[model samples]
Target: MPENDVIAAGARTVIRLPRPADQAEFLARVRDSAALHHPWLAPPATPADFRAYLERLTEPQTEGFLVCERESGALAGFVNINAIVRRAFLSGALGYAAFVPYAGRGHMSEGIGLVVRHAFTDLGLHRLEINVQPGNTASIALAKRAGFRLEGFSPDYLFIAGAWRDHERWALTAEMTADGPGAGR
Candidate 1:
């Protein structure tokens, strides 16, 4: 969307709202990242899917963030906050992926930090969680690196690919973070 919609930024990455104009490049990146995403994630790959994804973001409970390289503005990956609960809960779930060219380059690590900061500060969220399949070690590592603690495990937590998958729940509360709540603002 607008360039000014940046939620957060680091030295190498920037997180912002997804735009319709990014469809072509986004699809291509998804296609390229399919191998890495298999059995774990299934992001929007076609125009119709992308459109539907965008439409979902219009809802108050959902937010989609496109992580791009700061210097070149290349699509590094995507991180979504879904099923946000306000009022008593003030919590949200996280889902993220890094494109092939940017994977393992430490871009997503920085991006995840930015997302956590934005959720705590800008969004005024008190807690955030990431439900990742147990087999996905990389995703688990990312969550751990970003300061998320393993909460528990759920059998058949989310349906992915063709069947239900077991997942480990990782969480971070504002008070548990260094830059989170009670930090400065």
Candidate 2:
């Protein structure tokens, strides 16, 4: 994605690429949202950590996007597409977090829909997947609302919070929707 590229636009929010300058405000929000994110996520809360986060996303296999409220241009959350594979599978995994102030406000749902659309159309990928901890109901809800279907459950899908956690795999494909490229919109 290009710098500041507007990936998608919704009534309440816009999804765009994260910029280096967003470190200060993004870290501040992450710090303030520590409680809200505990046990569910652990986004970068310091300048150095945030920089490292950005660096990882700078790799060819990863992409980071920020969901910002259109009215104030304040970040509501972020979605990252990781492990992109292009040759045959044409798929990627998704990870995201909704900030404290924006949690439960439907920003993530809208943002995720946008990201799904971008993944299928702009990125030319066939499928996008999200792996959510079984206990994270909010994340699962967002994935379902955005049209991802529950595939299966894995015993030790990911190592999070210093332990191997079970995860529910959810996925969506461009071919699954009748509306084709405009389905997510």
Number of clashes in every candidate structure? 0, 0
The digit string of per-residue lDDT tens for model 2 on 122-171 reads: 88888889999988988998988988999999998888767888999999
The alpha-carbon deviation from the true structure for residue 89 of candidate 1, after best TM-score superposition, in angstroms, is 0.5
| RMSD of each candidate relative to the true structure | 1.5, 2.8
> Of the candidates shown, which would achieve the greatest lDDT relative to the real structure?
1
Per-residue lDDT of 93-133 in model 1, one digit per residue for the tens? Answer: 99999998999999999988898888888888999999999
**TM-score (all chains, Cα) for each model:** 0.96, 0.92
Lowest summed-lDDT stretch of 10 residues in model 2? 176-185
Model 1 misplaced stretches (Cα beyond 4 Å): 1-3
Report the error of model 1 at residue 155, Å: 0.2
